[model samples]
Target: MSQSPPARKPIIEFRGVSKSFGTQRILDGLDLKVHYGEALVIVGPSGTGKSTILRLMCGLLEPDSGEVLLGGLPLQAEQLQRKPIQVGMVFQQAALFDSLTVEENVGFLLYEHSKLPRTKIGELVREKLEMVGLDPVLARQMPAELSGGQRKRVSFARAIMEDPTVPDDETQLLLYDEPTAGLDPIASTVIENLIRSLKQRGSCDSYVVITHQETTIRSTADRILLIYQGKVRWEGQAPEIDACQDPYVRQFFDGKIDGPIQ
Candidate 1:
């Protein structure tokens, strides 16, 4: 008797995806896969469709051609309703509401979507805040009252607050779209360390981080994929970035003024 084939695990996959805006093509026949329980970092120059990939992954935008699959299934509206996957996304800028206090902002999804009492949600809010290495006192402050780093940290807390019931096998997938962009070196380090600590949380199965920062790339990536002209120019493990021989990868990682990138 013949044995059955090994089963393929569920994870995010992009199959020959292509997208265009008016006349400019953002992604062209791009194929990528993000494996479960791995930190996949996508890095490239600006305007190379890095952010677009995240949007497509989360169903914020649809590709003009090809498929975006989440958990071995197409990310269609109907499929999403039948079997929802927990996803947490952190935007480039800390997109917090100016009017709401930090606690309110963190618990906004819970407050609106669930029947949980405000006090209970507040407690959960404080929990997430602590996870991000933030003070509980900062919860009462408005967005305007906090510094850039504080705002970004609050955003992280909010993204993670919605799902508390998923089991270890059904862990949430986190996506970071330039989580440390436009912050001071110290503040950037804070976010990088937070990303580094994600595996310990046990609730997150995998993550996809899109960033161009060298430090963030080095510290957060388990595997790195370099995208250029809407295609994956180079791919390797984190330790292999410096040793990559591709001209585009060399130029980008080495910070050379002259190479094939231009």
Candidate 2:
């Protein structure tokens, strides 16, 4: 008999993780996993802890109870210095520094931490800009001058930036919080496609995106997770979304007020 394929390992895992603010519990004994080399989209109503999950993954927040693991190891404050794996986050608002030029913003981490010369960093920034379909000349322009879509693309370029000097420091996972928010349908499509294309280009091994847009959820996810009332209410492949019978899934996709979501 043929042997079964080896089990896939999760790049990120949450085990009985819980968090709260005052009396409001955002996550309660939640368990989730992001498998290697897959695109995972998280969809939910506002204030349901989707963004909080991204913050936890990126080390911006600590769970009140339970654990957040990276590459099968528990994530701890002291171990952050060693950086077992680099995790990059693209904020929902683009979050560019208004005073900085596109090049400065894209290469901010390297400029602050790497010993590389400015010229080399500039070249790397330009390369990433082109990869995101932005003009190289725009590197000199301030973030204030770019359109919303352009700013988001610039953020994408920044998230994928890596230091060539550190061989193991490549970004292993990317977290996007509402990446295509506040854009026209056409612009949102562009951002959504870029999210997939970057994975195809091997910029990051895996990515987790938090988006409520229907088109974004459909276009970018290999798998989908729906969070509700501080837990994962539904999980399935993207193709299975339409056929999913879960009340939370139905309420969310159908925009109905009479279901379990509210």
- For all predictions, the C-alpha RMSD in Å is 2.3, 1.9
Candidate No. with top TM-score: 2
CA error at residue 105 for candidate 1, angstroms: 1.1
The true-versus-predicted C-alpha distance at residue 182 of model 2, in Å, is 0.4
Per-residue alpha-carbon lDDT of candidate 2 for residues 130-153, written as tens digits (9 for 90 to 100): 999999999999998999999999
Count of clashing residue pairs in every prediction: 0, 0
Candidate 2: where is the Cα deviation over 4 Å? 1-8, 81-84, 168-171
Error of 2 at 259 (Å): 0.9
Clashing pairs in 1: none
lDDT, candidate 1, residue 236?
90
Residue 153 C-alpha lDDT in model 2: 98
* lDDT (C-alpha) at residue 133 in model 2: 97
Please give the CA lDDT of all the candidate structures: 0.86, 0.92
